[model samples]
Target: MPEKLLFGKYELGKLLGCGAFAKVYHAREINSGKSVAIKVINKSNICNKDGIPDKKIEREVSIMRQLQHPYIVKLHEVLATKTKIYFIMEYVKGGELFNLIANKSRFSEDLSRKCFQQLISAVNYCHLRGVYHRDLKPENILIDENGDIKVSDFGLSATTDQIQSFDGLLHTVCGTPAYVAPEILTIKGYDGAKTDIWSCGIILYIMIAGYFPFYDQNLMLMYKKIYKGEFRCPKWMSPDVKRILSRLLDVNPGTRITIDEIIRDPWFRKGLKFIKFSGEEENKDSLISNSFNAFDLISFSSGLDISGLLKSNNPMDDLERMVVEESPERLIERIEELGKKENFRLRKKKDWGIEMKVQNGKVTMRLDVYRLTEHLVIMEVQKNDGDGDLYKDVWRNKLKPIILGQQIPKIEDSDS
Candidate 1:
């Protein structure tokens, strides 16, 4: 194929890589003299040999277009031609975190903390946005010239509002075998956020040791160890470091140390020498730990531009009509009724706002409301079954679009 202009602007420089469905290129922005990466997928790839339509790649691109965050790779622009689709993204020059570790053996203590801080900030941002980045690994983490990291590849991510557990058990077998959470392997229901945390713990271990905690030619054995959270910290590791790692690698998601707590821990603090690179303010005590409060967690979303989703046509558009005349509980009950009719079971109450259980009378699917604006409501759902198809189908087929668009209802409006 001859070289072609993407989105009528990006000039393709050279082919970077090829996957089953798309080709990536290193490209240059014609106007600002900036560089970028462009991925082009052929529409033909969306169809099977029999020409059956496959909308998966298109859906992935649509979802990518809606997300904007610093820690997450930015999808700058997308253009679809009759035969192909193009994704223009900010190019991170430093390559994968995996390559960095392979070359350096292991990171210094201070460097690990800095990297962990960035990772947690990214994960927290996704959680608040009601998105879960289900696939997180060293290879998927891209670094830039300034040593900052960007979490890439949301191909496996999904909106939590719609996903539910499968057969009362978790279902999706997707994710890198090594970094996957123990609960995921058992085919038991698990939170997407919690799964990310498990990967984060594994990454931390790799950053410090330059090797995976569980590795073998046999994949099954590796999975077995992951479920048990069984691994030995090298004797050379500091006691403080070992203590923090143990908490993050906990097999039970419920007790797994949270990101907020990890960032607040002292072990992570010891790695912040570079934060004061100017050599003038190194004396200030570095705050370090993994634990963080919900309030502090929101800070990570500072760089995210959630306006796309907030502005999109959604079902909650009739907020004013729904809010002014009815109590908040009424709205909750209405939504609950709708859910039950669709086979989802309600948990009767909620912590932050409201909660619901979706299952086949055995497994649990999670739906938790985080906040509600007069015009908008934020929610997170956890589905283990990968049967997220049911909810997505409902949105595309049942829920009326444009119900809500671009307006966040104030807390005062939704609060009791």
Candidate 2:
């Protein structure tokens, strides 16, 4: 009945939403009894008709996998078949932040500030991990059952590794026009993180003012206004809030306030909880003593074709394991090296692998590495104590290189 429970584990409940290439369904994990949102993407539509690069979907998964922040949506697992790809994600009950704002017409300064603080905290965490959410708006932001914020829709996100060029700037022109930063309109390369900050400012403006900072029926006029950073704050707005907005909305990316600076600002620091890191020296000795599991290297190297290694007749079992090539020693070494660069602290070590913690501002992510065999290793990364998903791009762009010793080939598309 009901197609024998999609994936042999998840019981599809109701249709949640659908987009151009995928449909989202509310589902429950039969074994774990956990609720999740399963995004079913038609392989034919994405790869054939729409010509969407497989890597775009892969990158989104990659970025979401490594991000373990309170304000970001979580991707638990991915399953792909001949016809479709399914992403199991945390089911956020509360709906889009835009809906809340629309219903209220505008939020009080205290509420708006709280939402903006959470938004900035999440964005700051992304920046610390070298991830950039190219798209940031009320529509992409969600409110949980507790009324906390959760950022979602990372399909347009770009990591430093993805956007960095010889000049160290991103040239991509992607994202909703209204929420896009001014620098993105120049056609010249721009700093991904800084551009994201600009969008954050716009979201904050809308939350407090109940309207877009720059709006006109003519698209060209709107662009002109955005490029000039021309927007007037309501007279009722406080001077301190206006000052922060002005700095974030600066026309020049160079003049924009950095995330660190934002965190330090008096207005931003108010009511925010700061994350602390230990000063203890990293366990370089433990990393050196451990041997790498080859399976992990092979798995990361295969990229998006992990499903190709599935051999079991049962979808649930196959989804749990992937066999691949590579030595355990090399993979372990590579993960340790990359972990150091990403501020991940080595926690525990074993003969086959190790566990590490990545602390970003107020979030701490726990990563586990296990050697399934001499040539097979598996990695499980998630928040130390939450259902949030870690950023995925970190694994694809940062850790994958350590395994394969090269950059993942880029696919050119008119949209990018």
Candidate 3:
């Protein structure tokens, strides 16, 4: 009747909420005795004239699976019937931040400070792992039974790797209207992490004043005030709080205070403490045992095969202007000999590594040097970080002559 029994495990209960294209339900996992929130979407609901495709929902599921953080809402599994898709997620017992705000009218500075600290920690973890929650807001931030904030709704979340540039900026406008950053309205590329932080500032302001910072029923005037950084603190607000809010609400994404700095600020760190990074005593139930481990996790595969990331047609060829490192003259000479004899150019070199832009086109050859063991040289045809991969893919498919080789490439530049 309701298609498959929700991935053949969980049994759906009453409806929690419904939208234009989807519905959320309270469900229980038979195997683990765990309660969960199940979201179901009809494929046809998003398939009409001007709706997003079902594939985007699939992509959201893929992204959620990769994230394993305590502050983030976890996705247990994805189940699908012939015509519908279901996402099984952890159930948060507490209510929305908006409800709490409405009841309290406003939070004391001390309370807002505690909540902001927890928020910064969660957001910083996401940034380190290259995931940006583009839709951060008071409603999206849920408070658990212990009052610890849990950021939910990854439908708008995206990996930094999926984005072309950190600084090239994101122009897509998403998130709640009141909390939307100025850059979103401009349709210009903006840093995803920075944009999230801006919304956090707005949340902080609302928590203190019980009112929206920039208010207008008209979206255009609201955006104008946001772009101009036009907002004022209530008369009763302290100078220190006002000062911090000003910095956080700065329109220039680049100059905004990073999450790291926010946590270190006196206002946030004062009057609160955690035991052994195990979360506060009051929030013990909100924290998972192994939550701290994700903060410093790194994966290493010494035998990573990057040959496929390197094959391209527009290879680096010009050698005249190719600069070689003087400190590492031996390594430079070796690579120069290879580049010139092979009729290839090594441009845009850096410390801790080097990138060889092939002549005649944008195809690149790079060598990442590791000094830990024996000055190991790793070769990659495709860009391994940020926009490097996109350039690699473009060079490979859109070039005239195919570029191939195992040249060491010059390290004449710096990594920064």
> What C-alpha lDDT do the candidate models reach, one value each?
0.64, 0.71, 0.64
Model 1, runs deviating above 4 Å:
49-55, 165-170, 269-416
lDDT of 2 by residue, 1-416 (tens): 13438878899988888777788888889999988988888777656445444667767876787665567887777787766778878899998899999999999888988898788777876775568899899988989999999999998888765655467789889888888888889867899889999999999999989999998889999899889888999987899989999998999899898876776788876776442213222122221112233322432432334233232222222122233365566667777777777787664432443555544533344444455545666654444332223334444556556666565455589788
Q: Candidate 3: minimum summed lDDT over ten consecutive residues — where?
A: 298-307
RMSD of each: 10.0, 14.1, 10.6
Please give the RMSD of candidate 2 to the true structure.
Answer: 14.1
Q: Candidate 3, residues 116-142: lDDT per residue as tens digits?
A: 776766777667556788888888778
Give model 3's TM-score versus the native structure: 0.67
- In candidate 2, stretches whose alpha carbon ends up further than 4 angstroms from where it belongs are 1-4, 49-53, 275-416
lDDT of 2 at 364: 44
Candidate 2, residue 189: CA error in Å? 0.8
Better structure of 2 and 3 per lDDT: 2
For candidate 2, which ten residues in a row score worst on lDDT?
282-291
TM-scores, in order shown? 0.67, 0.68, 0.67
